[model samples]
Target: MTRFSFNQATANRWPIPDLVAGCVAAGVTRVGLWREQVADFGLEKTAALVKDAGLEVTSLCRGGFFQTPTWYEENSRAIAEAHTLGAPVLVLVSGGLPPGSRDVDAARRHVGEAIGRLVPATVEAGVQLAIEPLHPMFASDRCVVSTLGQALDLAAPYPAEAVGVVVDTYHVWWDDTVWAQIGRAGRERRIACFQAADWITPLPEGVLLGRGLPGAGCVELRRFREAVDAAGYTGPVEVEVFHADLWARPGAEILADTIAAYEAHVA
Candidate 1:
């Protein structure tokens, strides 16, 4: 329980104040925040609220969309936000290929370059840019770095403190090579964040929101936890599910279920 952090996306409709209060009431000391929610709530206000409640902002999601023309400016703002919120890591969702461009290799190379450009600012702000590789299904439009290995490769050039990779279960569970990559991430000290979300069956048409709570799906949740622990990742385990049905529930209920699931399947 000490290591568990509830990501805001898991309860998307929860108001910031209510979320913080509920977490405090439930003895949850950590949270992962999203940029959209923070912007809506007002960054300074959110920062103060969390600080007053004595809660830690585990990581800010996110800072990358390298395919966009405003990538540099937008990511710079994200780094600032993370710093203000006292979040040590800024999760990067490297955007996909440009329109009508199918060259995945080039798109990936661009992501690395973009990160290189942002490293200085991140280091200056005391924030780590954590590259998150989405599942390959999102390759065409969301993220081209579809494997943990690829994310690590992109973070290789920069110092590990400036750039690192995210190890999300839903994104990497299908890859047989992920175990080895997880080990490598530990050895190289490149794991900046670790997220857990199960891969549910009959993926909804909007696959982006098709994730399950820790025990609600077939993923070997305990195994992933043990792997990260064995790999020397002594960080918060953030539950970041994005299911429509889950989001529709009352915030407290969703949080209770999330904690129960994490305890039963992930702890």
Candidate 2:
């Protein structure tokens, strides 16, 4: 059975308690959270609440935005937070192009260096850093890790138990090399998270974040499933939609609809 989970990014405005409550109420078996919510609610309390509800936290929203100065401190803090939540994987969004740095290659190098420094801490905490490749559209402002291939390349140096890549359909559906990446990840045993969402045309308000449900758009999620399965990954196909319109509806309504959509399309 495909287990369902939602990224806290969907509930952009709701409190952490409310989001966890919503996930439980929605019958979602798993939940993923952002750093802000974790910090605001405090990690121990957040973990207790979710565990008390008997939910599996699929992964923590992130760590890693390789810039300078406080970058190391920030990454270490996120890794520690992941441990507190008991989340097996810590999703990492590599930082964007720094100012006065037209050299994307340089920015990428910085991301690589940062990951190297952070890997030890992640390993010590017994948390896997799941590198989440943002869409190419977000290459400038969000993450330089913009493709599964790129993310995998970064993961190559670390132990699979300590570092892996998050395969989110929303980010890689449009990539010409997705299948190859999936196959490689499965073969390498480096898949830590597998999430899904639809890709619609003309995009949406937060287009970089993704919009719609599985099979609701052009993403070949079944194909993605097939590839992942072939590579020997049987993890939950977490539903991480960031639709503004969906968020406007009641959380329960969204959850019910998401369950239906997962069954109809992803399963």
Candidate 3:
């Protein structure tokens, strides 16, 4: 419970102010925020609201999507947003292959180069860029980086303090090599963020919003938690679920259920 951090995406429809108040009421001191939500609520206002409520922004999601033509300018803004929000890390979901291009290798190489370009800005802002590898299902349109090992490889060239990898259980649990990768990330001091979500069956049509809350599916949530702990990652365990059905519920109800689920399955 002490290490649990509620990721804002778990309740996508929750208003920022209400989310902050609800988290305060629930005694949740940490939170992971998304850029879209923050922008809609006004960045400076959102920042002040959270700070005034005594809440710590764990990490801003996200800064990558190197495939976009304006990636440099966009990511520059993201870094500045993270700095204003007082978040120590900025999550990067490296975008998929460019349109009509089947060369995944090229896309990946481009992602590495893109991160290299942003390394200076990240270092100057005192923020770590955390590379998040999505599930393979999203390899084409969302994120090409589908394994923790690959994310770490991309971060290898940059200083661990400036760039690192995200260990999201929902994305890496199926990889047989992930356990060793997690160890490698720890040894190299590159595990920048840890996210928890369950893998549910019969993934919905879109699939992107098909994640299950902790204890809601087949993932070994506690095992992953223990692995990261063993790897010397003494940071917040952020629960980041993305299900449409879950989003339909009231924000307070969602937060309560998430906390309950985290306690039973993740904590």
Candidate 4:
């Protein structure tokens, strides 16, 4: 459990104060936070809270959506925020197809360009802009980069320190080529952050919050972990399940279960 980190979205309703306290009580040293939630709690204050509690903000949940009009400004701010929070990586959900556009190729090309524009700012902040490829089911509306290989391709042009990719089991488990892609991520030095969440189905329409705890589904959590480890990733493994029912319970209860699942399935 030394490398175990909890992702805040696992308890979307958990207030920042309580989540910090709960992690401290459970001996969880690291956490993955989200932008909206951090903004809600006041960024500077949240930084002080975690610092005071001896908790490390492993990586920020997100900071990319190139399709938006103000993407440059927004991503710049996100990089700054990650620096303030002591998070080394700012995870990027590389956005989805533009409105009324089926031309995925165009959308992906735009994403690459947008990310390149943000690389300089990332370098200045000393934070890695971590590109996360969402499950293909979310391809139409959430993320167009649907594989580790594609993420690595986009990150290739930038220095490894400036750009990297996120390896989240829930998103990449179904792809047969993931093992090879992970090796490429290592060789290219782009494996920035590794997250874990089991894959479950009967996916709610839109499929955003359909994740399960580590051992609750069919995903090969250990295999993904080993692959990323083999790929030269030695960072915190954040458990990030986003399910309505899971979030409804008390934050402490959820953390306890998440810990158990991680030990049983992912450790």
TM for candidate 4 is 0.98
Candidate that beats the other on TM-score, 1 or 2, i.e. the better one: 1
The models' CA-based lDDT, in order, is 0.95, 0.82, 0.95, 0.92
Task: Give lDDT tens digits, candidate 2, residues 1-267.
Answer: 336677776656667787778877766778888888788888789889989998888888788777656889988998888888888888888888887677888888888778888888998999998889988888887888889999999889878998899998888987899898889999899999998788877776667545787777998887887788899988777887887777787766676677788888887
In candidate 1, which residue pairs get closer than 3 Å at backbone N, Cα or C atoms, i.e. clash? Answer: none
| Model 3 ranges off by over 4 Å | none
lDDT of 3 at 73: 100
Error of 1 at 217 (Å): 1.2
Model 4 segments more than 4 A misplaced = none
How well does candidate 3 score on lDDT at residue 18? Answer: 95
- Lowest summed lDDT across 10 adjacent residues in model 2 is found at 1-10
TM-score of each: 0.99, 0.93, 0.99, 0.98
Local accuracy of candidate 4 as per-residue lDDT tens digits, 1-267: 899999999998999999999999999999999999999999999999999999999999788888888889998999999999999999999888888899999999999999999988899999999999988978888899999989998888889999999999999998999999999999888999999998887776647888999988889999999989888888899999989889899999999999999999999
Error of 1 at 85 (Å): 0.1
Clashing pairs in 2: none
Candidate 3 lDDT by residue in tens digits, 1-267? 788999999999999999999999999999999999999999999999999999999999998999999999999999999999999999999999899999999999999999999999999999999999998988998899999999999999999999999999999999999999999999999999999999998898868887999988899999999999999999999999999999999999999999999999998
Question: Which run of 10 residues does model 3 get worst, by summed lDDT?
Answer: 201-210
Determine which window of 10 residues in candidate 1 has minimal summed lDDT. 213-222
